[model samples]
Target: MEAQRDRLVTLCRDAGIGQAELLADTLSLLLEGARVSVQSVGTEGPSARLSAC
Candidate 1:
């Protein structure tokens, strides 16, 4: 997870995005939330909307 986050941060930074760390963290949280949501409520639940975001 740490490695993935680091890669995300590097990618964001290379793309010249400001607050790369924060963006990576936010993405991580969103993904984790989606995983939990899917596990608890199945793919047809609210987690399905995550792809629309």
Candidate 2:
């Protein structure tokens, strides 16, 4: 995860990505993981945050 974050930061830097766009996208996997993990425990929370890859 640490390596992936570093790569993402590097990729964004190299590609000149804006902070807002990055934040909007970076949380996609977070929400996905949260949703999938919750399914295993048989519980659902309020609407999850939306994000794009």
Candidate 3:
């Protein structure tokens, strides 16, 4: 799985997606997923949510 994913990522780079664009999109998705996971934790205690991330 890791090898296939690496190949796919390499292909995306070769196909002209800039590193910054890739990072931005990846980070956006990750942050959204994190937000949902945090909210699912019953809104208890401190959270690692980063509004500006």
Maximum-TM-score candidate: 1
lDDT of 1 by residue, 1-53 (tens): 89989998999999999999999999888788887898889989888898678
Runs with alpha carbons beyond 4 Å of true place in candidate 2? 20-53
Candidate 3, residues 10-50: lDDT per residue as tens digits?
Answer: 77677787784465457556655666766676444223545
Worst lDDT window (10 residues) for model 3?
44-53
Pick the winner on lDDT between candidates 1 and 3: 1
Models 1 onward score TM values of: 0.75, 0.40, 0.42
The regions of model 3 sitting more than 4 angstroms off are 1-18, 45-53
How many residue pairs collide in each prediction? 0, 0, 0
By lDDT, highest first, what's the ranking?
1, 3, 2
lDDT against the true structure, each candidate: 0.89, 0.57, 0.58
Task: List model 2 lDDT by residue over 1-53, tens digit each.
Answer: 55656666677777777773475357556655766765674454422332221
What TM value does model 1 have?
Answer: 0.75
lDDT of 1 at 15: 92
Q: In the order shown, what is each candidate's alpha-carbon RMSD? A: 2.5, 6.3, 8.0
Best-fitting candidate, scored by lDDT: 1
RMSD, model 2, all Cα superposed?
6.3
After superposition, the stretches of candidate 1 with alpha carbons farther than 4 Å from their true spots are: 46-53
